[model samples]
Each structure stands twice: as structure tokens, then as C-alpha cells.
Target: MIKKLTILATIYSLFSLSGNQTLYAQDKLEVDVGGALRFNYNLSSWKEGQKNRGGDFGYDMFRVNFNSSYKEIYLNAEYRLYSEAFGGGFLKQGWVGYHFNEQDEIQVGLNQVPFGIQQYNSHNWFFNLTYYFGLEDDHDMGVKYLHVDDRFEYNLAFYKNSEELTFGGDSESSPNRYSYDVVGRNKEVNQFNGKLIYKFGDSIKSRLGVSAQYGGLYNLDTKETGSHNGLALHYEMNVQNWNIKLQGMIINHDPKNLPGESDEILQMGAYGVPYEVASDFSVYTAAVSKSIPVKLGPISNLEFYNDFGYMDKKVDRFEDSFMNVTGVLVSAGKVYTYIDYAAGYNHSWLGGNFVDDFSVGNPDAKWEARFNINIGYYF
Candidate 1:
């Protein structure tokens, strides 16, 4: 099935490429390809009192993007490849669009669901700085419609997704059960999402967005059926050198399980004092990140940055799971290099229980500290 999907994507890409040639005389075609190399060192990998230290080095990503615009028509395609160790491989995105006028357009194809800012800026390393607050949603093959004006923009999308898993670990073996967020069986799922954004001239930029998805899970053997639903709210603001964003999500089940469990989540973050020290230098950029569990306590974190062109100075607390209170002060002239350090009390929280299982181990809570160094490039 994956191979067939890849072939279909290739065929679609060729079709779009050929269409670009005759779409419009004023149309333009563009292509982008880039990759990132990173080496990370873990100070503490052993649980609690054990000492298991190791590091990873590899190409984090390799991706190609194609975009074309012809008069009132537009098309885009992207393909990405990465190491299998990171659960990475190849995925494709293809979409075709038409502009009714300067401010209104509609697109239909395998496209992105406009649920979060980070989801739109996947190619960036920093991930727009807002993504760290946990608003990143997955992409889907679906139909989408978008409307954009001077100050207001809106997006609506519907998509379907399917997967097959055998709990016994053999590919040919049929699993005893099947489930999905929207449908009870390992069948196609119907998803719907919508977003609205309002920009307030130079003073403040704000957006209010909401999304709800519902469907059923079909059991293959017993033919049992289960239902699932997810709802979320997102808001963000940018004032001067300060930026703040908040998001909340409620799920009635695993969203992937036929008879999944229910869970709720809330996350928020803020950054301030983005000052420029020189023509290509900046200082005093600080941020705070927090997450509140539905029934557990809150996790507080902080991050600091001083970037100067190719060089950056960073210090923060537990950027993600398996990392804690890490700090890095590096100077990259042409080659990227940095001396990193960190210390924290715990690496994670929640004791790895039902909540972790429901959310797929997202928003991991851990406490620890470490130090390391590496060199890399971005082009």
C-alpha cells in the first residue's frame, strides 16, 4: 500500500509539473531541497540510579519541495526522507488550488490540515518558536478550502486516514482487534477541521481557531463499532518583541483505538524581550513553557537565547522528553559547533501510566541534566 501511494504521488507530481507548463504564461516553477545534520549526547539514559550514556549522529532530514503558480492556479508537492531509527521514512504531499479572486481561493487534494502554526512551518528548524507549546498536528490526504483577505483568513479541511497493525508483530498475521480514532475498524477515517485568523496591524497579531473531528471505529472480527471525537482551541498573540500562545485539546478516546480511552490536555508558552545587539546579532530573548495535566500538577520550564548570526547561545530546561535543564553556548563560524550543558532533578513525570498510553507518550515529563558538543550545517 505504501509503495502504491508513493507511485501515485509521483504520477501526480508529473501531472502538476506538466500542467505548470501550459497553465499560465506568467507562471513560475520553484524547487527547494535541503537537509539537516545533528549529533546529540545524552548525559543520563539509565533509569533513576543507573548510568547508561550514549549519543546519536545522523542526517536528521532530507526533503524536496516543489511549488508552481500560474495566474490564478497554484500547485505544490513535497517529499521527505530520514533515518528509520527515528521512525522516519518517506511521505508525500500534493495539492492543487484555484484563486477565484485576489483574496479567495480553494484547494483540494492530499493537503495539510491547518490546525497549528507549526504544522504550516514544518521546514523550519526553530519551528516558528510557537510549536513548542504542543499545537503540532499531523497532516492528512484530504480536501481543503482556504480564504484570505487583508486582515482575516480562514481554512476548512476534511480527510481520511487508515493503518494496519498486528499486535503479534508478524505482518501476515491478522491482529485479534482493530481500532481508530474516528472508526472502530482499521478502515478509512473522516476528519474535519477549521481555523480562523485575525491580524491587528503593527500593534498586536491575534488568532482564534477551533477544530472538531468525529468518526467510528469498526472491529474486523466481531464487527463491533466504537466512536471517537476530538476538539481543540488555539490562540496566539504577538506584541512588539513579546509573543504568547495557548492551546487546549480534549479527546474522548485514543483517537486510534477502536474502543479508546478519553483524555484532556492544556498547554501554553510565552517569549519576550527580543532585542537586537548588532546588525546580525540579538540578545535577551527569554521564554517560558508550561503544561497542565488534566489531573496532575503543572510542569514549569524556561529558555534563554542570544543569537548572533551563525552563532547562538542557548540555555533552557528540558526541551523535550529524555532531556533536562540543558544549556549550550556555541560559536559557529562556517561550521556549527557548541558546548552544551544541563542539570535537572527529573527526566519525566506521570510515572508512565494510562495517561501516557492514551496520548501516545506525548508531552513527556522528565528531570535530569547533561553536557555535550557537536558540529553541523543547514542549507
Candidate 2:
């Protein structure tokens, strides 16, 4: 069993440009520890052998999270363990934060980047297509600042690089990471991010935001650095128990490769694998879901959703890519289960060799589908 503790600490006042926040001499430190265990079962249309064997079911991951706070200072971290085939084990995120006041705060260390629809843009376990391009739910070693108000939110961050102390590989850019990033002959560096969000509405609350990223791409062979830029617009709405999301983004990576290397396609890697991706592209995604109260004994609620994304490469000869997922989430006490059916065309994770699908995709390749179920229990 995990232990929870609250201890008295010497309080310190946080001074800011505006004023000083007074803290009592005696403040209590609050700590909470929790985690989850997950499992997965999947059947893929592209895997004939897997279908013949009636699919596969196995352990997915085990993770632990720690959070503590005292006065205006706080810290949180998460570590995860997965099967060796999925990159073994690594720290997801660990950061220390401080509150200048109720509206302003700062975080330092490994933290999620401020971008797009926030922690996630899709409801399914697979996430949205933007995740593969390093635009959604991406985390890096950096510093972050946040400002919040009644109707607006602002985030600014500077990331020196991705988490380099990952599980596998001895190279400068390791593939055993939780998020996709520039790997192989190039790496991401000196990245800056900005996001602004506005909230409004009476009966139907809505939020609209824009995110921007600018970074340098360092080519190992040439020892020269190039640049990358990305811009995105995201919107979400909640009307009663119904939810909707829409997003669009454009990304460009210009790597200064060696004389013989082509810059048309850049390499991105994660989860102990590398794949090719188009250098210049635009992505659009839409997702919707509705929650319904359930009375199936232990079951409490059900959420049904559909998510879709499309990628349009700027290169004339490159083929397009798309993914669609329909799923349902069942919540019962501490256990949550997701049943999903996903289909993709020219997508990397979905099918078709799983290598150059995001680059010059196989135009002759047919769409592939996968049936998946993921269940997790929280403590």
C-alpha cells in the first residue's frame, strides 16, 4: 500500500513584481501517491498471422505518480514500466512548480509542452494523428509559465530538448521515448512554444485556442542546424453531456543534411522504433463524444465517441494519410475500459509496412482496421 503523509513545514513568502504573498510560519506539506495497471487486447486486419492465432492479449503498463505541495511550491512526477518490446521503462514527467499568485505559475524540469487541445485531442487510447507528429501531448525537458483568469488562459514555454536519458539506444537521439521527435540524423533543440485560450458561453461552454512552436533542427552529420515551425488552431465545446473538438495545424521541418542526403523526408522515432515522415504537411482533426448515465450494476457511465484525422503532404508526389476511430468508454468504480475500432490509410501505426507510410505512402495500399480493447484500474 502507498503511504500518504502531511507534515508541517516552515513557510516562505513568494515575492513577485506585483506584491508579496504572505505565508504563515507553519504550513503543511500535502502528498498523494497513486497509479494504475493496464492491459490490452487487439486484432488487426493487416496481421494475418495474428488473426489466425485469434489476436493477442497481454499486460500493457504499470505507472506510479507522486504529487506534493507546500505553501506556494509544488512537485509532481510519474514513472512507468512497460514490456520490453514497448521500450521497457522510463520517467514520463517530473516537474517542480511555484505559484506567484493564484493566476500565475511556473514549472521546471520535464513537463508536457503547451500545444493544441492540451493533454489530448482525441478520446481513444490511440490518441489523435497529431500525436505522431509531436504536436499533441508532447513532453520535453524545459521551463514553463502559465497564467489563468476567469475567461482566458496563457502558456509559454522553452524546451532545450526532448528527454535524452531515455531507456534505449546510445545515440544522441534515443527512440525509446513516450513522444515522437526528430531522431536519426537530426534532433530537436532550442524549442519555444506559446498558447492562448479563451473560454465563453452560458448553457454551452466553449473554448478556442491557438498554439505556435519554433525550434532548431540539428543535423548530426553536417554539424549544421536548420529550423522547424508549427502553428495550430483548436476549438472545443461542451453542451450538456455532449462534447465536440476540432483542430487544424501545419508543420514544416527543414534539416540541413549532408550533401548526399535528401531533405524531402525527415525521420521521427519513439517507442524504440524509427519511421520516415514528410517534411512539410498540414493536419486536420475532428472528434465528438456523448456521455450517458448507466445502470448496469457496477457500471456508472458510458461515453461513445468518434475521432478522425487527415494529413495532406505539401510535396506533389507524396500521398495523403488519414485515420478514423470509433470507440466507447465504460466506467465502473476504479476500473475503466475502452472498446475501439480503428481504421487507417497511409498511416504509420495503423498498417502498410509501418515504415514510410507518413512519407511517400504506398498509393496502392488498402485501408487497414484494428479492433482493440484496453482496460485499466486506478488506485
Candidate 3:
């Protein structure tokens, strides 16, 4: 953050010294500052002790956002502060963009990868299972080009690498990040992404898109570069106030590891923790939601949604993973809340053990449930 502040100050000084007062006067800068404070209550079926002791409610996160623009140049960034156990503080995303007319633009710096869906594909707070695998809404340090028209949209991006933490010497990448990335002995680098979306229909609008990505997995132990690739087909449709989303994807990872190291699993880290994942897998997801407006005192509207995802491993003896979430979002002026009942089987972020749940998980593991409610006030 200090670095960003210094850069802004330097730019101001240079502009003032150049005596270009008219240049600034012609394009008055616009800025908007906002933030949110959130809290959560959770009760897990797997955590018998916590359930017996009457669940738990605590602070979730506090985030501040900035959106500023001077003519065709714009900047957007967000900083978040989580609890110490949840990775402390980090920059969620920061990017500078330039507009070349209405049809084209470019974004530079840490930005979202143009893969899977735009912005986000899920309706609930937990998102879909693809998010945990770093396939949905992942961000990295890179540059991207975007083109949009009435019927088509195109995105092309090249990421040099994932965001790195300078203070952690023992690991190649920090676990204290908002998005999951390849870590441990291998790091994600030199990634290329392309996506195309076609929009059609009138009253019942629909969008069909295809996305693909290829990247290098640099193995620290072997000092060699391996490869990984993914392809996805996604479709979204809206009829009346109902929304439907569907997606399928295939991914493969090949890493060069030292002798005796298994190649079937890779390490992925985020939120200040590391976990194992199947190197090769296929994912399928479907979701539906309905928006209804009501006059329930302070409650103005409600959105009911259900999201589901499945992960099938390619390894011969590996087990599959599944996740489902049913919830409703309540909106009352500046206050918003989500009430969710989420369940999973052989899922890492769910109920199973942390590190190996997505790797070679138990084939007979039973489904576990977690009931949660999250509330936030935005300003």
C-alpha cells in the first residue's frame, strides 16, 4: 500500500511541476470510496464439540474499495483485513485500465483471469467448487485485453506469475492470498488465457462462452518447468426473474518432480494454508436462482438459490468430490445477509481433513453439513 501511495504522490508532483493545469482541468477526476463490515455464524455437523456448545458467531472480514478515473484512464482496487487466523491482511485486487473507445480496453497489474465466468459465476457466498480449485475468479499479476460488442465479447490475457510474498523465504508463494494458486514445490507462471462469449435472445436472454488456459508449473526441487492446461464451456440464461448457470471443464497438470515424489497430486494454497489436489480432473456445475421483491418491513427483496458442483478425478483409485449449497440472500437497505445450508463429500474446504481431502480421499466418506449465516453492512 505504501508503494501505491508513493506512486500516486510522484505522479501528482510531476503533473504540478509540468505546469499542466489545463490538462487536469479538462478532465476532472472522479473517485468513490466504500467499504463493508461482515460477520458470520456457523454450526458444523462434523464438529460435534462446537455443535454441542451452541455453534459460533464472530467477525468475518472488513474490506475497503477504491474506484477512481480521470478521463479514459481508470483504477480499481480493494484491500481486505481478515482475522489473524485467516491470513491477516492482503490486497484482493488492484488494476489500472485504459479504454480505447467502447469496444476495446486493456487492464494491467494484478487482475482477474479471463476464464470460466466473468467476475463470478456463483450465487451464494461460498461460490462453487471450482473456486476452491483455482479455476473460478482467480487473479494473478498480468495484463489483459478486452473487446466487447452487442453480440460478442473477447478476452485475452497473459500472466507472468502469481502474486508473491517477499517475506516468506521458506515457500515459493504465500498462503496468505485471496485466490488459490499452485504452491509448495511448484509455482504457477507464464499463463495464457483466452475467452469468447456469445450473447443472444431477447426477453429470455442467454450467454454461451468458452474459455481456455495454459500455463507453466515451475518445480523448485527439480528446477524444471512442467505444463498445465484447462478448457471450459459455460452457459447462462435468464428468464423473467429466474437465472440459470451451467459449466463443465477439464484440466490436466504435469509437473517435473524429484525422484520418489508422486505426480498424481499437487499442492494448492490460499487463506494461509496448503492442501493437496488431484493433478487431473473434470468438473461440472449447475446453479439456479430466483429473485422476488417483497414488502417485509425493512426487507425489500429476497433471492433464493441453489448451487452444486462435482469433481471427478482421473486417477484410477482416486475418489470424486461433491458440494451443494442452498441459501437465500436477504437485502434490507445497506444491510445484506445470507442464510445457507452447505454440504459436501470428499471436499477439502468442507468437512474432510484439510490437506488431503481433494487428493486421494476416502471413497466411502459420508456427506457432511454446515449451517451458516453471514451478515454485512456496506457503505
Candidate 4:
């Protein structure tokens, strides 16, 4: 009887182990989906010379992620959908990744170039208020590798160049009107990036990284070629209640253009903020409640903060030149509410000679302003 009882217990233990293994295997294949919706109202002109004001509400992003692992092999897939103000849906990202070993992995599909911090900033809804400086939401089909270990991480990728479509005014256009292929247009672009992170003490840490890209353009129609280069410097530090980040970039556009064709600039910015607030519920009795606290839950769980920003740029003889200032105030919780205001002055320059002065006069640069309010929910 004792031998029979021992046999039953061993069989039960084996079944339990098998069940646990099946559960673990199931958990390895996981899928998730999420997205955001945004509504924007533009009380001012869209750009410099336009006279029409507008507003739009649409899906900001709809994305899904798939992760699976079998034995020593791993796989990942991500997809994103977006719509513009004019009403059309487009695929933002579609990518797949494979893991060969614990420390190395490769990905291919449409993905963002792993270049700088600004390219991947996650703090704000709109990336840095201006879309011109950083390569915002720009991606291409490519292959990437990631080597991650204890003290260092490296990312490298080569991707199919993206293409831009140009259209003619006020009518249906042919699919082959004018297309700019970023890859075929450029000779070859290779991006290299690395990060060095060190931890000193329990609460303080820092990281520094440098990234660069070099490539040339190839004109499919004209068979012309051009070169391009971009470099960035990034650094961040976290200490106690403060976190700081600094980034800078130097870019040369159309370097292969004639004597005055290329445009180059150096731009940089830094941000620092406290990690946490001292008071759970604090009311400021001021003219403008810079910090407002509203009960997000039974406990004083959530708070709201708002700020305004302004910038002005002045350049002559440039088609896309303008001077502008913008401000935004936002609140957060289960839902987000925000307001944006912007104003700008725009003008054009025409070449002329001193004596003859055979040049058209600059039109009165228009003054444009826009006010937008948005409410969104996320899960």
C-alpha cells in the first residue's frame, strides 16, 4: 500500500510540472493594442501665406504589438495607423524583429531611424512644439541590430529610403506626378549610434551618446546625385529629484547643390525638471493657477500643470521663412485637455539691382494666429 501511494504522488507531481510549463509557453506569446484620439482647432492660418483657418479631429495613433518566444528564438511585430486632417488613413509603422541570442537581435520593416533623443522623446504630446528641427515621425523600411549588455548598448540600421509625393493644385493627379525617393535619391545613408551609461550611487546616474548619419541622394528621373550628413550630441542625468537632458544637432541639407543650394544650421536645447512634487494636494491662490490640483481618484492621485512657449525666427529671401511665437497649456488625468495659441509674421524677398531695381515689392507679410483646444482619452 505504501508503494502504491508513492507512485500516485509522483504521477501527480509530473502532471503539475507539465501544466506549469504549458502556462509559461502561453504567456510567451503576448499581444497588446492601444491608441490615442486628438482634436485640434486652428484659429490662425495653417502656414505663412494661407488665408484659411481650420480644425480637425481624428485618431492620433492606433498601434498593436506582438511578442512571442520559442526555445531560444524570439519575434516581435508592431503596427500603427494614423489619419490626417483631410481624412485618409495611413500606415505609420509596420515592423518585425528576431532575436538570435541573449545579447543580439535584428529588426526589419518600416521603423524610425535610431538617431538622437529628440527622435524618441516621450514627454510631450507634440514633439518639442516645432516639427522642423527634429526628424519627427520619419521612418523607412530597414534592417536594424541591437546589442545590449550590462554597461553599454549599441544600435545600427540600414533602411530603404523613404519617398515624398508631390502634387499639382486643385485636381486629381497621376500616381507618378513627382516622387522623391529618399533611398534612391541618396547614394547611401548609414546611421551609427551608441550609449554609455554609468550608475554612481543608488539615486544618481547619467548617460551620454553620440549619433551620426551620412548618405547621398540619387535622382531617379534626372539621374542626379547629392550628398547629406547629420550629427547629434545627447546627454542626460538623473539625480535625486531632478532630471536633466541636453541635445544638439548639426545638419547639412542638399550639400550637393550648386554654390548656394545647401542649407546648414546648428540647433540645441536643454530641459530640466523635478522628479516629484512634495504636496499631494496643493492649491495655489494666485492670479493664474500655474499648478492646479483636482481629485483624480478617491485619493489625491493626479494633478495638472500648464505652461506657455514662444519663439521668433527672421530670415530674408526664403520661401518657408517666418517669425512666430506659440503658447500651450495642458491638463492631464484619465482624459487630457489642452489649449494652443500661435502667431506669426511672414514675408518674401525678391532679388534686385541698385539702379534699375527691377524687382517686385514684398507683399505685406500677413499676421496669422491660431487657437486650438483638444481633449483626448487613452487606454
Give candidate 2's error at residue 238 in angstroms.
Answer: 0.7
Q: How do the residues 130-174 of candidate 2 rate in per-residue lDDT, one tens digit apiece?
A: 998888878899999999898999999999988887434335687
Per-residue lDDT of model 1, residues 1-379, tens digit only: 0011112212233333111121322233332333335554333333454243255444444544455554566666555554554335433455777777767666666555666443432211232222322224344557778787777778877775422233332222121111111122223346667777775546766766665665553434334444445565656565654445554445443223324322122111112101111111111112222222232122122223221111111212212222122233232332344444433221122123312211223344443334445455433
TM-score of 4: 0.57
lDDT of each residue in 1-379, candidate 4, tens digit only: 0011112212211111000011112223332333455555444354433233344444454433333333333334344344432223433444555566667777666555666553433222333322223233445557777776766666787764442223222221111201112221123234333333332345756666766766554433344555555665666565653445455555444523234432222111111100110001111100011333456553232222222222122223322322233333344544565555443333111111111111121244454555655566543
Against the unseen true structure, what C-alpha lDDT does each candidate score?
Answer: 0.39, 0.86, 0.85, 0.37
Better of 2 and 3 by TM-score: 2
The clash number for model 3 is: 0
Clash tally for model 2: 0
Q: In candidate 4, which residue pairs clash? A: 44-369, 44-370, 161-183, 185-217, 185-218, 186-216, 186-217, 186-218, 187-216
For each predicted model, how many residue pairs clash, with residues at least 3 apart or on different chains? 23, 0, 0, 9
**Candidate 2 Cα outliers beyond 4 Å, as residue runs:** 1-3, 10-26, 166-170
Better of 1 and 3 by TM-score: 3
Best by lDDT: 2
| Poorest stretch of ten by lDDT in candidate 3 | 16-25
- Tens-digit lDDT track for model 3 on 1-379? 1111213322431111000011111155555566789999999998989989989999999988766556677777778899988888988887777788778888888888999876777899899999999988788999999998999999999999898877353468878899889988898889999999999999999999999999999888888999999999999999998999999999999999899999999999888888999999999999999999999999999999999999999997998999999999999999999999999999876799877889899877889999999999977
Best by TM-score: 2
